[model samples]
Target: MNDRPYHHGDLRRAVLTAALDVIAADGPSGLSLRDLARRAGVSHAAPAHHFKDRTGLLTAIAAEGFGLLAATVNEATDLKDAGVRYVRFAREHPAHFQVMFAPGLLRTDDLELTTARALATDALRTAVAEVRPAEQGDDARLAGVAAWSLAHGFATLLQSHNLDGAVGGRDPEEVFRTLSGLLFRQG
Candidate 1:
């Protein structure tokens, strides 16, 4: 047990950081509010004050993850850039990425989570619109889905080390750029 002070001005942030560390190390299933409180050097019940329960904590993580993802991808200049950024976000925030997509573990109706999800979806749609205009209607939606699937699948594979043989020595972003180029022809 760390000897951190019992009082914290930002207990929520402290608890969230501890939760992320736990998730990254042992996966979400191994997480416990008690463990988070210990990691944060607070009382056993301290985490509950902010998170209420495990689901609430997971919801917060999902919301934060979506917000971060939206900001990351929103900076892209094009669809390919957005895809690459998405993959990078997964790599950089593996704990958040893992929780963000697990609908069963989160409060699907959480206002913050829903709003953040919308922001991320909108960011992806904006990127898709740059290539496939909205005038194409369903085609644009389909393209967005395809792009998201490709990026998400690639990120999952990369994190699982399943791409070691296929990617060889190449950087992931460069490989993603090449892969996206081959799959998506700019019109």
Candidate 2:
């Protein structure tokens, strides 16, 4: 019940990082602001300054996750490579991805979340541009959705162990590349 305010300059980031770890280890149901404070080594009420409630904390984590995802996906040299990168990001940052798309858990209206989502979407759009260089407007949008679906589905399947038996003895990355190739029309 320590009532001292946290003077740490980056309390918000600390709380969000802790929350992500907790969610990763125990899922969303195990997250608590007080528990985060304990893990963060801050006073119980310190988290309130950064996140008013559990939802606020979740929103922050989702926002950070999206930003990281965008950065990771955008680093690929080509659109097809970006799809592979997206799957890698999901696998490498399982905790972040878990919170990023867990519906109703994050505050979608929060400014940080909105901006992060937009950045992530822009990364997807860039990948689409690489695929459909000449197509503009609606066609590009459609292509983006299709590409995202392909990558997301593959990542989700891998994450959930849905493809374990199907791809026996094959590296997950190799499986992802093979599956992605089937879904994507290569030029």
Candidate 3:
């Protein structure tokens, strides 16, 4: 429908959904405000109003990603479950996963993004606490870092399809569970 009639109804959501579709199809580098507007059936300036610039849009996606991640991580029964969920989240939301890690593309100072990131971090740290005994200072921080690094690295590789054939036809989370077991299980 060329010359589409537009209304302000859910325009912001439409733009964000269009942005996700664009990111899913063409990667973040290919994202354009004009294209988002076209996809959302809004004026070019509409997207700009919602997200001041490209970085703002990316920041929105990153913030959304972290919020989703925090919710997923919180669903875990333990650290191993959290790791598995993390990988699954990456697999399911590839676009979000990609944008969430690329700091250079997003507005790092965005309050929503920072807050959502903190939520995700808190979720991860909660899982880490289950993985390691109660400890003070850097010890707990170190454990959380190590746990996050391992799970994140695995999720990244899984998202890139680096572990495609390794797991055969089995569920990816199952493999993640097995891998997580290696670290979660202590001697």
Query: Evaluated with lDDT, which candidate comes out highest?
Result: 1
- Candidate 1: C-alpha lDDT: 0.93
> Would you estimate the TM-scores of all the predictions?
0.95, 0.90, 0.93
lDDT of 3 by residue, 1-187 (tens): 3466567688878888888888887899999988888877777777778789899999999999999999999999888889888988988898999999999998899999999999999999888887575576688789888888988898888777787889778888888888878877742
True-structure lDDT of candidate 2: 0.83
Which residue pairs collide, candidate 1? none
- Model 2 TM-score (2 dp): 0.90
- Give the lDDT of residue 107 in candidate 2: 83
lDDT of each: 0.93, 0.83, 0.86
Each candidate structure's count of clashing pairs: 0, 0, 0
Candidate 3: minimum summed lDDT over ten consecutive residues — where? 1-10
Task: Tell me the alpha-carbon RMSD of every candidate.
Answer: 2.0, 2.0, 2.1
Where is the poorest 10-residue window by lDDT in model 1? Answer: 1-10
- For model 1, residues 1-187, the per-residue Cα lDDT tens digits are 5456579889999989888988988999999998888877788877888889999999999999999999999999989999999999999999999999999999999999999999999999999998899999999999988999999999999988999999999999999999999988766
Judged by lDDT against the true structure, how good is candidate 3? 0.86
By the lDDT metric, which is better: model 1 or model 3?
Answer: 1
Top model number, TM-score: 1
Q: Which residues of candidate 2, in runs, are more than 4 Å off?
A: 3-9, 134-136
